[model samples]
Target: MEYKWIALSNTTIGVLMAAINGTIIIISLPAIFRGIDINPLTSFQYLLWILMGYNIVTATLLVSFGRLSDIYGRVRLYNLGFLIFTIGSILLFLTPNTGDLGAIELISFRIVQGIGGAFLFANSAAIITDAFPAKERGKALGINQIAALAGSLIGLILGGILSVYYWRYVFLVSVPVGIFGTAWSYLKLKELGLRSKGEGIDWAGNTAFGLGLILLLIGVTYGLMPYGSSQTGWTDPYVMASMISGAALLVSFVFIERKVKYPMFRLELFKNRMFAAGNIASLLRSFAYGGLMIMIVIFLQGIWLPLHGYSYSETPFWAGVYTIPLMLGFVAMGPISGWLSDKYGSRFLATLGMVIVGIGFLLLTTLPYNFNYTEFALMLFFMGLGNGMFASPNTASIMNSVPAKYRGTASGMRSTLQNAGQTASIALFFTIVILSLESSLPTALATAVTNAGAPQLVPLVHNVPVTGALFAAFLGYDPVKALLANVPSNLIPATAIHIMEQRTWFPTAIAPAFMGALRNAFYIGGIMTFIAAIASALRGKRVIAEEKEEKEVIKNA
Candidate 1:
């Protein structure tokens, strides 16, 4: 009934909705492609767009939305976000085309949803900080962050279940929640946060920053796609041009911010030790873990589950089911860590969390492709606990360091870095995997075909596109089947044909190569998280802004 509780509950719903949509499409992609009558193997561009578009838009817009909320009103923008997001969901659910058109429509609608998500993400933390007292912010933020993580995990399972009956249900499920949230937010949420009364929007800075980030993220997304002879497009002229131009624009944005009267980005905020270190640590942690869930899901769907006798159709649901331990660990530790941080400083708990997460990544490398379920589950749970411990305390430290009038801008900057880091992580990690596969997968495929008494078909299947193979793994399709679709029956014996056709053969053959590539990713992730731990340690001590202000006033008096 209290205003703070009201703010917390509404923002939690907004965050949960935004986070759920972020991941819901991933597990449901196979079914979505089927529903739209599109062949995923031949539609890699559509797949990439569908997967990355929402994140790209959300990441690009958060800072601007945050700045705007500071000038206008946080609650007003947040309510608009809820309404826009609901509209996007409705459009996606009622998609009226098929094939390429359908995929394009879906991508367009998702971008709309991303716009709304940016608004919600940019303001939620600021709203929460404004509503709660300084000492209680950690607990409030912890619950909020927990909703984000839980929503992502819940989206995976929910998508898997709903997609079984109809793909449209995936989008449909968000509609009622969105409608209710929109109405509730508009009616009950108040403009309680301080606002900058007359700061004009810095259009020049906003343009440069938004366009720059858009170009950079788009370049990264395409960089994961195949370009001519290369397995990845990092060297393509267009990709290079986009990235270079994007970098130039971002540099210009920095200068523009320096000269502007009312800049969108609050660069001066970085001078604060707590704010700087907390944000840097948050970005590194996000970079380290963003693609991790997807990678694990791929391992389960493409290899482990299939080799263990689960059908391709069943892999999606089971993959979601098996990851529950990670969620459980997060739920258990989130509140406890928040409460602890409120009593002590965030420095110790936050640093310890990154250390634990780093260790979990390293321990993951020890598992073989056919790792025992118990070991795998425990490792996942361990990583989840580390994330739960870090998220809230770190967020609380960052929000509490800034002045009240700038909380919206600060929150936006934080969300932007976090989202951008995640988007880049997925692109970078996927590229790493694809490059690894390029060198090793062809030989492995050739050898597997020869051993299966299909030497005649070796050359045909050997040079399969690495991107296609990776997509197959993500989509739960058998790459070998698609590769051998055109082969004459007479060219291969019946027994060999049957052997290659079994659901287990390709998974068995690819596991060794895939695991090797995956281990490389894990090693890099471990190193990144460890560096994040160092950053977290560098946050020094927690300083509450209001308390410091009060002390300054007393001394002056």
Candidate 2:
């Protein structure tokens, strides 16, 4: 109890490390690919594996970890988590391979990092709860949440800088922090809450949920890959089958959890209105927020930043820099919202935050795909601010609405929704963008290429797939240019061929197709954001009213 501050500090470090690593790899992916000498275009599966592998491990392990934390000492599991995460980071920095082997090693390394992240995520909240009293818990959690968000943006910027300067520095950044935090937590964080021993491990529930989530995530990840020349693979028999089976298994997992004596996922938590509503809103909010970040990254690194004179390599760093507005919004409003929720209730803040995000989304739509940089920055800043506003208060509401004993399960449940929502969002947005691009890109290119000069060869050009065109832009590659030497000298002006090779041209050429896709995706995102906000507002009001009524009854007694 005396080491509460140390507990908070240690867990914060753990959470921050995990959160940053989540997307640090994203911005640094170009360098990561290069360091290992893998071309993301031809190596598209590697890209999916690299990205999906981390999420799969974290998502798969969270519930089991949470349940174990409840039975075993949270501090014990937490210390082990730190060690695991640190080892993962060390291995990643020491990656010693190239090409396919290198890519596989990187994916394997990332999966290990995810295991570390799952440990940190699984127990950070429970530790915080143990360290802080109920009322003070929100403040502590708010600070932790803000750090996590701030770390994400920081990771973006850090990854960009480190990856640009030296690829290993990206992973190396975590080494010392992990060491210090791990040592400190082992020394300081005490096991105080939910140290129950009666409930045994729910092996069936763990296996079922983990497998189900993993299979579903893999299906979703690969589902983004073009199937037989189709832009999106919704119709891919394999993708469809994986998805159906995954869903069925997950449904069965739910049943398994209910029957199990010690369930990792406590299905009964939903009976709490505040818990249920908060989770619903959390999932939807994540659904909106998840893809938005990637879309914004693509918008900046893939398009806007490059269009505005920044190099492709420089775009990631700047993209992170530009995204600080969201962090600013979070830092500014998160504590206040948490405090206010502690007073007036979470409903208002949650609802208002959602509305703010919704407005921000609407603002995004009005700007042309190639709009004024200042206006674009302004809109993004507001959007970040809006999302920050919603996340903290909504999370606090979800946690606060449940009973003390249910807190562990409640947190896990909430996080699961969030994690799952985000994963789905990425798949959803990516699908939309790719599918839209696939439809019209070929015609546009054919006309554009022909207009530039030499008759486009029917066989050579036709043999080129639309998926290649889409991936060329998506992974920031141009498959055509990669094979430019083969083209005849008469394919028009030499300048035209040169233009095709530049980074700006790919994004600009695909702008018409990409812009529509971007707009449509944001529109959907905006609607989802607002829906989450409404749910947030509605949940807090009902929960607060019920608690007040219960308090009055106790007072009368």
lDDT top scorer:
1
Clashes of each: 0, 1
Q: What is the C-alpha RMSD of each candidate to the true structure, in Å?
A: 0.9, 2.8
Report lDDT (Cα) of residue 11, candidate 1: 99
Best by TM-score: 1
Off by over 4 Å in 2: 454-480, 483-492, 498-504, 540-557
Candidate 2, after superposition: displacement of residue 402 in Å? 2.7
Q: lDDT, candidate 1, residue 142?
A: 93
* Tens digit of per-residue lDDT, candidate 1, span 117-184: 99999999999999999888999999999999999989999999999999999999999999999999
Q: Deviation in angstroms for 192 in model 1?
A: 1.1
**What C-alpha lDDT does candidate 2 achieve relative to the native structure?**
0.76
Error at 536, model 2, angstroms: 1.5
lDDT of each: 0.92, 0.76
Instruction: Give the TM-score of each candidate.
Output: 0.99, 0.93
